[model samples]
Target: MNGAANIDQGLGVSIDLRATPKPGSFYRGKRHAGLIDVDQKGAFPVSQYWEPIYHDDTNEIILDPDEFYILASREAVTIPASHAAEMVPFNPLVGEFRCIMRAFSTRLWHE
Candidate 1:
């Protein structure tokens, strides 16, 4: 289920991870992707491994600028077999950022 109270004109709902008090994680260092075997899991280590992220007393996760993070939605979404869903990485009105979904992780860069 979407966490947003209402859906927008674009027929998209917002999923807020920060709304819930849950510890997140991030990865630092340069990003890269070399030759990988489809049969192997984590064939080559990309950047640093997943590091735990802690929230402050107010339950706010402080992220460093220009760093890469992989965060999940608070809600688990399910689409019909005939239907599909596309993830819009960023919204300028919300903030300037970028998200790239790779074979390893869904990287989110906060500007």
Candidate 2:
């Protein structure tokens, strides 16, 4: 979910790591994640809500400054039989690192 309040706050703060602020790390599973390139072809993953693989001459996804990408995490998630959970981001205020899991309109999150 795009944080409504976060968008309104960090209008032009000039994000950087020089602040040495509290660090927030992500749990990239064994499969990690891949990027979808704008030049990707073939079928669009509308139903699956999956992004395409980004590739360049180096065959690596180039990360742009202050840009977001739709990634697929292969992390193993095991929920307790009687437990319920929600996907919450660490801290958008940091802007050093933040994550958002957005699925297709059919659902909020996907496998």
Give me the candidate number with maximum TM-score. 1
Which runs of model 1 end up more than 4 angstroms from their true locations?
1-39, 42-48, 80-82, 89-94, 97-111
Global lDDT of each candidate: 0.47, 0.36
TM-score of every candidate relative to the true structure: 0.46, 0.28
Could you say which candidate leads in lDDT? Answer: 1
Candidate 1 residue-wise lDDT at 25: 37
Q: List the residue pairs that clash in candidate 1.
A: none
Error of 1 at 77 (Å): 0.9
Question: In candidate 2, which residue ranges exceed 4 Å CA deviation?
Answer: 1-53, 56-59, 78-95, 102-111
Query: What tens digits encode model 2's per-residue C-alpha lDDT throughout 41-106?
Result: 433343243333434355344444364444433343334569544544445664443434322321
